[model samples]
Target: MEEISILLLFDVLVGLTLVWLAWQTLSSLDLFRAIVLFIAFGLLMALAWVRLNAPDVALAEATIGAGLTGALFLSALAQLSASTKRKDEENKIENS
Candidate 1:
């Protein structure tokens, strides 16, 4: 009975944390911060899947969901920043 209660508590905590992380990721003002939070959420989701006895799903979530997707987002963000910087420099040159 005690072991079951402890497992229940763990499950509840995991569920609540997942929801909170999702909210934080969506509501974050900074794009980088949001992306980082999304990665964290994905990792936690993988853990949750593992707890639920879904190792294949957990592996997919950790690798493709968090790893690949996060890398792509960061790469896109870097490209956008570089493009904006180039545009700003061009604008400055035009103004001068």
Candidate 2:
């Protein structure tokens, strides 16, 4: 009974965390923040899979869904930031 209650509490927290992370990922104005939230969402999803006794699925999610995707997002963000900086410099040069 105690074990069941603890599992139930863990389940509820995981659900809430998934919802919150999804909402934050959708609603964030900052691109970097949204990517971070998305990565967190993926990790929470992996945890949910682990709770369901699917370690293989959880491993896939952790590696492919979160790790690789987060790395991709970060890579894109760097390129975007660099381009934006270049554009801003061009604008400044034009104004001067």
Clash totals in order: 0, 0
Cand. 1 Cα-lDDT: 0.97
lDDT of each: 0.97, 0.96
TM-score of 2: 0.93
Q: Return the number of clashes found in candidate 1.
A: 0
List residue ranges in candidate 1 displaced over 4 A. none
The 10-residue segment with the lowest total lDDT in model 1:
7-16
- Tens-place lDDT digits, model 1, residues 15-88: 99999999999999999999999999999999999999999999999999999999999999999999999999
Colliding pairs, model 1: none
Clashing pairs in 2: none
Model 1 per-residue lDDT at 55: 100
* Residue range 1-93, candidate 2, lDDT tens digits: 999999999999999989999999999999999999999999999999999999999999999999999999999999999999999999999
Residue 69, candidate 1: Cα error in Å is 0.4
What's the TM-score of every candidate structure? 0.94, 0.93
